[model samples]
Target: MDFLLEIIMTPAILACLKIAVIILLFAMPLGTLLTLMERKWSAMIQDRVGPNRANIGKFTGNGLLHIAADGLKSIFKEDTIPKGANGFLYLIAPFFGLIAAVAIFAIIPIAGPIGNFTFQVTDVNPGLLFIFAITSLNVYGAVLAGTSSNSKFALLGGTRASAQMISYEVFMGLALMGIFMVYGTTRVSGIVNGQNEYWFGNLVPMWGIFTQPLGFILFFTALVAETKRAPFDAPEGESEIVAGYFLEYSGMRWSAFMLAEYVSLVGVAALMTTLFFGGYHVPWLHLWENAPQWIVTILQILKFTFFTVVFCWFQIQLRWTVPKFRFDQTMGLGWKKLLPLSLVNIIVTALVILTLA
Candidate 1:
């Protein structure tokens, strides 16, 4: 019993618990909150009031109550399985998406190390590759949902989704090759540390954005497409496909899909923070190296959270601002345009590195 207690008190176990709590309390809730914010944001863009009707007594919480209301509604709502649907796959599909979305956080360092505990769940050496591997499984969720539904529209959406995700994924990987070449390591912590320096004798940050501007653009565009936002959301073209791969899902299952989307949105934002925006490193934070460790930790956490929220807002704005693309247009842009550009970016990055070396 003492040994077991000691094991439970170990740093590894504590880190795991911290990670789980952060994901559940912070990441998941933030994602759901974004759903409300998205509505309000779009309404503001369109010059309309949003979501103020959800209230308790006189306190509406300015539509903040909608998040809880939505959750309770989903819980009580009837879950319907299609008449001819594959019951097993239908039930498990949402979990695939939710898991994939949440798993990416494991490699993201939230606020550097605090004593024996790091903010990240795991410090995998091949951090970027691990992200790609896990995110690749997300396609399975859409495919399974579509195929199991036994609906033509669902299948079409699934097919388009898989193709789109695969296409953009290639560009996304290639675009980041420039960063890997510049940083010389695939570990996210290594990359973040690399960005902590200043360039031009303290005049400018040596951030990934400075070193890989073109790569940032390319990677961000590919990421937005990967998340299936507007202008690239042909897979779920609601105008044509009704509700796409999730047409048959209802209640909590449907909620799970929505949650996965928002959660994935947050995950992408965090990745963007880690890869290009300097992770938790604030500008000139090195000047405060002698500050208390707790103060530094809090500052880093706030910085990371701010950047993540900004990126999430940017994504929401992009969704409402752009019109959906046609299927052919989407395919052409991914394959003919982004893919070629990513390759060129990599080539240029390599040559520059060789010249400097």
Candidate 2:
């Protein structure tokens, strides 16, 4: 046991373990499960049982078998590259989204810090800016996939994705400025710590949602748009653009693009929990400052996971609940409506901060 502890308890090992815990245990598994959950949940919402065909010897496992069935089907399918397509760029494009999506988890805190060890992968000072940079790279996946497909439809989808993602990026950052100001720090860990603070002598927790309600609304709207989910999913509208930027991909390559979207869906949930919610801090848990560290940590993790899953389900529900926006209408909402509102939110936050000070 001491030998195992010596191997597992080092700083380097702990960091690597945190990465595995976040990426493999949490993000990837939840993201993969969501692909099926979306279908199942949507079916339930619309009064139907979703995808139960995959079975073995009279056992269906309900709809859970479909996950493995889908994977096996994708693995056996042919991957076709378009004639005259840029082979290199087409091959690499799918990874950009997946990479960017997976990277977002690096800064998210799953539980409060425990002594020298933290629940997060990295607590960088330029926390949110790093997020912006990573998210911007996701645009390259759509653009490259569309451009290299040698098809007008794919190119159009890519173009739309580029414009929409870029536009929402501005609003997303602007919406977050309020949180940055209210928390008085850009470091995500610091922000989470700040939210543990109560207002008016413990009457209420100072979660970002309570303090910056408008900012929260704008920020979440921007997150939905940024992920190119429903309403804002004009880039991939099946009625017009078919599959959009990834129309030509097949096999696991196609799955990669899809996985990127689902993974990003999970990433968005984590970010929402970290920013708008109180992160891993349980409401009033700090009231017992002398509580055992292990119990506090467990409760914090549970609270964080609960909020993240709720947000994920909420996003999926939102996709099915709202109708898709027209491509032009989508852009207009971002520029004319959300953009201005985000700016106003930031201005109001600054003034409020000054008044309180």
Candidate 3:
């Protein structure tokens, strides 16, 4: 019993557990709020009331409480397992979806520092590869869910999803090559630290977005495809495919897929912030450098959270603004356009950096 307890208490095991719960708890709600924001923003864009109806009885309109209402609605709904579906695989699908979504946050830097420890879950040497590896697992969930459903629409959705993910993953990783080249390290925390020094002593706050705008564009486009989101969301084409891979899932099972989608959105946005936007660095923040460490830490956390919320809002707005693409068009954009462009950008950026050096 003592040996077993020792194994359980190992640093690796405890770290894994902490990271797992942190990713799930934080990522899940961020996604849910993104869903609500999508509705609210879409309403604003179209000059219509979005979801004010989802409220507590007396108030009739509570902005944040709508999320609570949505959760309860999903929980109380009747869970239905289809007659022809593979019961075991059907149950497994949503869990895989959720797990894939939650796993990607392991390497993201959320705050500057918490005491002597970094707020990053893991300061991995191969951090960038870890992110791509975990995100690549998303395809399995979509494919398995679709194939197990035993429905024609589900199969089509799954196939489209798999193809789209594979095509985009190539360029998604390629987009970061410029970042790795410029920073000379694959460690995310190192990249953040590298940006701390100014270019001309005016607090330039050198971010990846400014140095490699094309890479940023490529990353953003590829991420949109990866998340199965608008302008690239051909796999789950609601109008044409009728809800894609999750056509047959109902109740809590279906809710899991929905949750996974939103979580993925948040994860991608957080990544974009960390990789291209200097993580939690606020412009002109050096003046407060000599301030109390605790105060500085709180300011950094606030900055990170603020940008997180802003990006979340941006994604919601983009969803409402953009329309889904044709399947062929989506694939063409990834393979024919984004991929080649990203490769060229990597080469150009490296050459420019070397010449400047």
Q: Return the top candidate by lDDT.
A: 2
Error of 2 at 108 (Å): 0.4
Q: What TM-score does each of the candidates earn? A: 0.97, 0.97, 0.92
Q: What residue runs in model 2 are displaced by over 4 Å at the alpha carbon?
A: 1-11
- Candidate 3 C-alpha lDDT tens digits along 1-357: 999878866868857765866575667767887777777778888998878766556675546678778788889998887779998887899888788888778877776775556666778899888889988999998999899998899999999999999999999999999999988899988887766656777647788888778998899888888989887888888888899999998878888998898888888888888888888766567766577777777777677777777877777777778877888888888889888898899889888988999
Off by over 4 Å in 3: 1-21
lDDT of 2 by residue, 1-23 (tens): 99998898887888799989899
Q: How many pairs of residues collide in each model?
A: 0, 0, 0
Pairs clashing within candidate 2: none
TM-score of 2: 0.97
Q: Candidate 1 overall Cα lDDT vs. reference? A: 0.89
Q: Please write out the lDDT profile of model 1 over residues 169-223, one tens digit for every residue.
A: 9988999999999989999989999888888787798888999999999999988
